[model samples]
Target: MKRANFIFICADQLRYDALSATGNRVAHTSNIDRIGARGATFHGHLTPNQICSPSRATMATGLYPRHHGLWRNGVALDERLPNLWQALSRAGYVTMGVGKLHFQPLLAAAEREMPESLAYWAKPGSERWRGPYFGFDAVELVMGEANESTRAGHYAAWLRRNHPEVVDLYEPEASPASRAEDLKEVWKSAVPPELHYTSWIADRAVDFIKHQSNRPEPFGLFVSFPDPHHPFAPPRPYCDLFRPERMPRPTIRAGELERMPAYLAEGDDPKKDPYIASGEQPREQGFLLRTDDISAQTLAIAIAHTHGMVQMIDDAVGRLLEALAGTGVLEDTYVLFTSDHGELLGDHGLLRKGPPPYRQLLQVPLVLCGPGIRPGTSLGALTSHIDLFATVASLLGLPAPATDGIDLKPLIEGRATAVRDFLFAEYHPRRDACLYNQSVITKDWRFTRYPNEPAWGELFDLSRDPWEHWNLFSESEFSSQAHRLNSILDQGLPPQPLIPNEVLGAY
Candidate 1:
């Protein structure tokens, strides 16, 4: 076995633009920035299936959403596929997944959130909770990201119930108003508890690194953190870190809906306008879901609070780094920090995730730092999260497994390379009865196919319109480009596939 090990850190729903190294000013991510300075950073990284379960399954199997059959959340990954963890384990590597294994092995607790319409619906088996995930030696999970009301046997609650001092040593703070919406009862209750969830997870990781010794060889630890996801609840200090007045707001145009396809605005049951004009305040006329109750500054607080959550996550990352160094496993570990997907904070009149694929939820940040990696370098080539498994394999000198994701080692090593020419992502319920959306992105262009034929479809040139406000699907100039990208859609993708919606619009 190779003497080196791997430490992977994942931030839940962390946007690519939220990192200071990536030009996000409103927030701070010093630990991530330090890692970027030590190794290579891919600014163009993306998740083919940009959601929690699907993208994480992609990361595990090194397969595309089509190949893995985990194209949607709350669905099971095809059992037939051989994953990186399993392969590495067989090849004499110590593979231990530390956090957030979103793969749906069974329909029980952790996997319960998966919709029944998806395939391979079953309950989480003994292997789901028991260690050696696919191949990892140990796994202490925090039940697919939980809160007070929906505590799903997560690691934090486990620690709080048992080992609370670990948190005190690393993060001795109270997360005021960091509870779930349903847990508002506990939000204002007494002196806020000492250990927060994010820190608790990190504290457990530190203990695991220092104590766990069952592995016979070097380890590859998937240190996953389900932070900055939903609830937007960082503790009191972090929660109030940023003021909304200083944060930037979206620049909406009057003709925004005119450029977009009609179906995008079709789901407005309350008769709200599909698009909000520039300089106009957001109206609650069914334009968006999720953000049901909004006072004037509530939206602003949500934005600021989201950034605050990100900053809190940043501090947690620092603690993890300190643990790695303290454990005397610093140089021997190949560290990877990334997110399953980005969070769309008020982009496209959207609040939280699901229901659609906005840029705020699609584009994620990827920073890889360790031996043999170039520091502070950015690859302009487009990439996808499915490439993670293969990249890990390459770093360990293991053969790339049979999967749809491309091995990004060449691009990361500063080799100007040809990675994925065109990337595609899928979302919706995995079960047959549920509908979904498919998005195709090329270097310059993007096309989204909506299931159930919503209001309209979206097409944009990311190079020209990073905000993705312009819908160029109706433009005749890109007819050939659209066809060319569509041809590479991998017809023999994975196994059973989610049906792609036919868009009948102007172009």
Candidate 2:
């Protein structure tokens, strides 16, 4: 029963109220609030897909992107399903990943321009090509943002081998253009903060936990932090760490998009979308359709550069937990921290994320911490993100993974209180069919719908409108709780069977 030793990280788009132990009074994530003050903090987790490669292909195949087919964002994950990094590398562990594993499909790595050629690890004896790819035996890849245009992989070959004079500030014809007419919401990066890319993903995840600390198997790593998502760039002293008149601001109601769901109150039009009109603000348009054409001091300088990119990923999660307590493996390790969905910083008046399933884009920001967990616990039940692949295959005793996500380790060790009474999400529409949608939150309603406009939907009673600003889906006394949560999204999540890569051979 050795097991225990994972890492997980993940950041891109953050927003579970932008932390500070989830009470975020303008971001000061004391190292992600010390992992919820040392373990377990699900505050209703969610995010089965609110975009970003289909919620990171449902946390790498714990299914549900309609059975992990990646239903949107240039879809891809069908490299024969079964994932969680090849089931923790066939159980011997030691898997690895560095940053932004949007599990393939950032516009197919810019139509295979293979990130400005460093592909195949700069060839000529391809040094063991480092990766069993999706099941990631090893991978470093990084794409987009910080001088955009899919910012070349291997973090631009480790910024052309250790910051070759600011590796041409991440290219795009040697950067320099964003004069903020909304280049996706903000910008400033001239590449600093020790040559950014979130400091090369926390120095390659503290050099892969100092090269897998005395390796005798058991290791998992995943680090991945593509910033407080968007061109909201943050560098140098975390770009003036928060002070847009002391943060908060973005809620903006005013006829709340006429009670939402006219395909998100008729928003889409990032200049007639071609993926939001090809980067760096191509004649701006989707801050939920120009939230009355931006301004509250440009959404308070893009929420004060997204609270200085979440305090530069909470100071790279306090230097990867001080490199796992300086390689003593920080009490056998388990870590977790989350994000792969969330960002609308402007709430109902929107700023990012689409097809509004709101709750600031499907909640996100679970915590976790190590071994037997439970310290300072929080768990408001209703979890998701495919329950972190069945709570890391039930903390390594294995089995679980054919998918619809369940083992949240008995609801984070308090021996369960709730794992599901309702919490589902989906948005399968790559390139607008009005951004297709579906949702359900329950434990006080949140609804959503829109199967191609089922008379347009959304309900939100979230325990008396938790900032949803009222919709009541054409209320008539909440129409039998929106037809019993649309019949639990029409009896979904039950039919997972596909792990058969052949056997029984004596034919």
Q: How does candidate 1 score on lDDT?
A: 0.62
Superposed Cα deviation of residue 322, candidate 2 (Å): 23
lDDT of model 2 at position 59: 86
Candidate 1 lDDT by residue in tens digits, 1-507: 446777788887888888888998777789988788888778778887656766887888877766666655434665457887776777776666655666652232323343211111223332244454456766666543324312344454455557654333222124333433321211211112235566666777777666633345776667777667654445567666798788877445456656754433533222232223333443321133433333335667667767876776778778767877887776667778889888666666555555456677778898888878876767778888878778888888887666777778888876756686777777654322223567777777777755455444567888888878777766789767655655554352322334342211100
- Number of clashes found in candidate 1: 22
Q: Could you say which candidate leads in lDDT?
A: 2
* lDDT at position 32, candidate 2: 77
**Runs off by more than 4 Å, candidate 2:** 1-4, 14-175, 181-185, 192-194, 217-231, 234-256, 260-290, 295-340, 345-349, 352-360, 363-390, 397-419, 424-472, 482-507
Model 1 CA RMSD to the hidden true structure, in angstroms:
8.0
The alpha-carbon deviation from the true structure for residue 16 of candidate 2, after best TM-score superposition, in angstroms, is: 14
lDDT of 2 by residue, 345-437 (tens): 766776676667778777888897887886888888888888788788787677655678888887788887897888788775534554466
